[model samples]
Every structure is written in C-alpha cells, then in structure tokens.
Target chain A: MIPVIEVKDVVTHYGSRKILNHVNVDIQPGEIMVVMGGSGSGKSTLLRHLIGLERVSAGSIRLLDQDIGHMSHHELTRFYRKLGVAFQGGALFSSMTVGENIMLPLREHTNLDEKTMAIMVRMKLEVVNLAGFEHLMPSELSGGMLKRAAFARAVIMDPALLFCDEPSAGLDPVVSSSLDELILQLRDALNMTIVVVTHELDSAFRIADRITVLDKGEVLTIGSVDQVRASTHTRIQDLLNRRFEETILDPDEYLARLTGESI
Target chain B: MEHSVHVQPNGHIVSFSGEIDLENSPAARTRLLEVVEYATTVFVDLTAVTYMDSSGIASLVEAYQRAKKTNVAFVLISTSPAVLRVLQMARLDKVFTIHETLEHAQHAKH
Candidate 1:
C-alpha cells in the first residue's frame, strides 16, 4: 500500500555529526506508529525530520504525496496545518486558562465567531475528559490533566496527522494506560494517522500497531510487538529481555568469590 | 466517625473494610498514620478489602514509611485474596508481611 508518509534513504545531520543515516520507513493511515529507542538514539531527531522541524541533509521525506524536504517556507507553513504536535511537556501557556490554550489554534487557523469558537473549545475539552475545568489555570491541574488538556489542544483542528512525544511520561501506570486508551480513541474517532515517539516499553507494547526501533542512528527492527519480542537480533534480545548490567550483578558475597576479595 | 483505630495496650490495629480509591485514600492514610502513633506494633487489616488500585497501594507504602520513621513495626493482615494478589504483583509482599487473619498477625512477633 502507498504509505501516508514515506521517507527514502533520508540522511539528516546536525552540524558535522550524522544523526539519521539512510533511514527509510513508511507510516500508514489510522495506525499508531511508535518510534522507540534508548536515550540519544535519534528518536526525536527522526521526528524532527518527519515534521519538517529540521531540513534533510540528503534524500527525501514525502508526506501525503508531497516532498516535504524540498518545500518552500510558504508551502511548508500551509502543509503543517494538517499535522498536530503535543510536546513532551504538554507545552501549555502558564498564563492562559485551559479554555484559552485549547482555543488558540482554532482562533489562529479559523475565522469562526466568538460563539462558535467557545462551543468548539468546550467540545475539545470534553474529548479529553476535562470539560468543566476549562476555566482553571494550568497550575491548578494535575499532571495527567495537563497532558490531557494539551492533547485536547492538539486535536482542536482535527488534524490528519497527530504526533505525540512521550505522552505517558511522568504519569503513573494506571493513568498512563488510560492515556494510551485515549490516544487510541482519538485515532479511531478522527481516523487520524498517529506517530508517537516514546521509550516506554509497556506502553509501546500496549498501543502500537507497529513499532520501529532505532539504535545508534540505525534502524533495528520494525514489526508488531510480538515479532519484535521474538527477534533474535542481539540488540533486540538485550532490550526485550531487559538485560541491563545492574540486573546481572551477583550478590556481594558472590561477587567477592570472583574477585577473591574479603567482604 | 471515620475508620477506627483499636488501641490496645500491646499494639494498635487500624482496620479498613471497604473500597479504597484515589479520592478517599487521603482519609485512609491519615487514619493509619494516627494508629501508628499509639503503639509500637501497628497492624492493618485488609481481609475485608474488595478492591484497591495504585493510589491505594501508594498510600499504604507511605504509611509504612511513616511508621518506620516512628520506630513502629507496621504489618498487614487478613487481605482478601484479590487485594493480596495486587500487593504481590506490585512486589509489596516482600516489603510487607502478609497474614491469613488479624489474630494470627497480631500474635506474630514484629
């Protein structure tokens, strides 16, 4: 199938350091495509390349059959309207009430009158389960509520492509799972193509239709969670099994046996 | 009144026998903390507990820490199998001693 977004042999660099090398992937519509990696593994860098936040150093990134790499500034501005980004921190304005934050995008992008905009704001808040708290300032909300409000703002325009950076971070597991369900609900409700950049293993396994794992600027594997878990690739095995160095450490008495040292 | 603290001369028993959820966890926590103040051995009876979530677990962990600070030995008893399973899943059983009945728990040495 022709993908909604396709990157072909894309090589992106920061100054002289190459970050994304020969990266190629395809994202389909109405699926949650997760980009996962360890820290400094270029997950965010790849997102930047995909969203046109950074220009490609080589190759092409095609979005909706248009070449995003080669677009002019004016064209890129028009193209971005179809995409939505909920930053890792929710990135809400501290000065604005929840209603204003959700209303900003609609106000800037549409010519709707005050009455219509107000209704739309309420609708978006309801989508995120924050309907009645629209008048509350950002500081008055809990961590989970803030993330949901930011999510409400992201979808205010009913974007075709929704991008979330670590949507589950800082939330407890139960709350995180609920947030995952909300993301899935939004995807089905709007029929939107979703791309999530996260390193959370449990969340990734729960919500992803397909996952693309990156390590040291290279593609590791791209498949369903079961396929990735069953893969025998050394890197994949180490990651899936969580074979961190700390977990392998023997008790101090056992360690002393190997070192021939007294405890 | 809220949940009661049975203050015997030997130990303090704070028994909870209902749903403990996020909205009411604060009250539960306060009740348990108050019980720890009266006795060196504090027993929490949860055999009647039907359901508990992460917030309830967190409140218990907090109470455990507070009891430790006061040199009180905190123990949990009579957790329903369902609630016991959740505590075991979260690996809190290793940190807490689980008992089949409040009497068995109160009699066991801390």
Candidate 2:
C-alpha cells in the first residue's frame, strides 16, 4: 500500500542555521507515527514542513501522494481540506464559541447544510469529551479543555491525515493520558494516518505505532516502541532516560563569541 | 456512492453502496429525509457501504431525528464493519435501531 505521507531527504534551514538535515520518514495509512526529540531537534520544524507551513530548502515532502512543495497556492488550499493540524497551544479563536471554532473548517471547505455542520461539530466535541462545552468561549475553558476543543476543531471534517504538535504538553498526567487515548481512538475510528510531534515519552509510547527519534535535525532511528526502548544508542538512551546532553563548544568558536571577533 | 430505494410492504429500504462522505452525504441526507417524510418506516441498508465519514453519520442522525419527530420508524439494516466502527466510536450504536439483515428488521418492531 502507498504511504499516506512521505518525507524524502528533506532539509530545512532558518537563515544560515540548519534545522533539519536530510530528514526522511514515511507514514502509512491508519498508523500513528510519533516524532519525538529534544528542544531544537527539528521535530517541530518537520511537523511544519509536513503540513506545508515551512518551505523545505531541499528534497520534497509529499502528503497523500501530492508534492506539497510544488503545489500552487490554490492547489495547496484545496489539499489542506484533507489534512488536520492541532497546534501545541490550542489555537482556538477566542472570539468564536467552541462549536463555531470547530465548524469553521466545514464552513470554509464545503457546502454542506447548516444542520449537518452543527451535528458534525457536536459529534466531534462528543468524541473529544467536550460535548457540552461548545457554547463556551475559549477563555472559559481550562487548558486541557482548550486542547480537547482544538482537537475537536482539527477533526471536525474527518481529515484523512492528522498532524498534532505537542498534543499532551503542559497538561497533568491524567489529562495527557486521556488525550493519548483520544488520538488512538481517532486513528482506529477514522482510519487516519497520524503524525504526532511530542517530547513527552509516555504519551509517545502510548499512542505510537512507530516512533521516529530525532537528534540534531536528523533521524536517529525509526522503530516500534520495544525496539526504541531496547536500543543502546547514546543519544536515544539519553532521551529515553531523561538525561540532558552537555553542549561541547569548540575552543576557537568559544573565544570568538567571548571576544566578539571572528576566529 | 450509489443508492437505490426499494418500497417494501412494511417500509422503504434505502440501500447505499461505496463511500458516503462529505462529497455526497448531502444527497444522502436529502434522500433519506424525503423518504422519511412519506414512508411509515425507513430502512437504511449499509451492507455494501465501504466507508462513511462524520457527515454521512450526521445525515443518519438528522434522518433519525426527523423520523422520531414524525413518528415514523427509522431502522439501519446490515451495517458494514467500517460504518459500525464509526457508530461505535461515538457510542451511537446504541442510539440507532440496527439489525443484521432485512428479515430481522422486518420481524422486529422498533
């Protein structure tokens, strides 16, 4: 079967600094692929690239068999209807009610009747465990509630591919665990190919069909949870054990920075 | 998706095949509601339905509500596993009147 998402030798840079170095990953249909890394490891950048947010400096990112890099503006807009992205900060519009936030995608993409759109919003809220919170404003909800509402909006249209950035971040263990279960249930029910970018090990292990470990803008390993847990790679072990790596700076570069002079 | 409506002695049976998704769910909703307006009983056959998204399920929900309000019977007959999983996800399997076959739906009273 054709993979739903294919990231091939993708390279990205912010100004002169390289953020993603020849990254490659393939996500199959109905599979949850977790992309996990430390801060500045390019996991978030990769998520942005996959969702067509950031332009890759080299190689290509294909979503649902279409090369996003080559697509025109109009084409990309149409293509986005098939994908969903739940941002890290629960990017609900404060002005709109939760129900309206969820319905926004349908309103923009399709000509389905108003009643159908309303029911779809309710059903999505029900799926996300925010059934009766639809009438409430974003400010009225707790952090976890906001995240669930974000998820409801992301999935209101039943997207074929769902990308979640830090889904379980900043929530307590209980709420985070519930969000993990919700991701699993979404994949099972909707047959969605999901790419979840998270630094939370427990959440990654709980929902990932396969884990893609990244370090320094490169893929360290991509394997099942057991394989990842058993690997003896230093960086991977450090990540799994929550050990921070000490940054070693070159003597000349350090002197150059301290003296404000070129080496 | 392709659909056919058969008027039986008891009710109108609407059989849908292929995918019921955002593109065509509006049509399904319109057809189901129109049939429910006149028929005493409506049976939605999903045995051949390959896929159904939230919109399609919403169509079913709307029709079911209309049926309830009109005092007409709304029954789902022979649901595919794909469709059933989605229904079960929302815990809607318990909400709709479902049966394994037309014979069972005919014999059972809603």
**Strongest candidate by TM-score:** 2
In candidate 1 the C-alpha lDDT for residue A122 amounts to: 67
Clashing pairs in 1: B47-B78
Point out where model 1 deviates above 4 Å: A243-263, B1-110
For residues A26-49, what per-residue lDDT tens digits would candidate 1 score against the true structure? 999888999988887889988888
Q: What's every prediction's RMSD, in angstroms?
A: 17.7, 8.0
Q: Encode model 2's per-residue lDDT on B11-88: one tens digit a residue.
A: 999999999999999999999999999999999999899999999999999999999999999999865888999999
lDDT of 2 at A11: 91
TM-score on alpha carbons, each prediction: 0.65, 0.94
Off by over 4 Å in 2: A243-263
In candidate 2, the residue pairs with backbone N, CA or C atoms under 3 Å apart (3 or more residues apart, or in different chains) clash, namely none
Cα lDDT, model 1, residue B33: 65
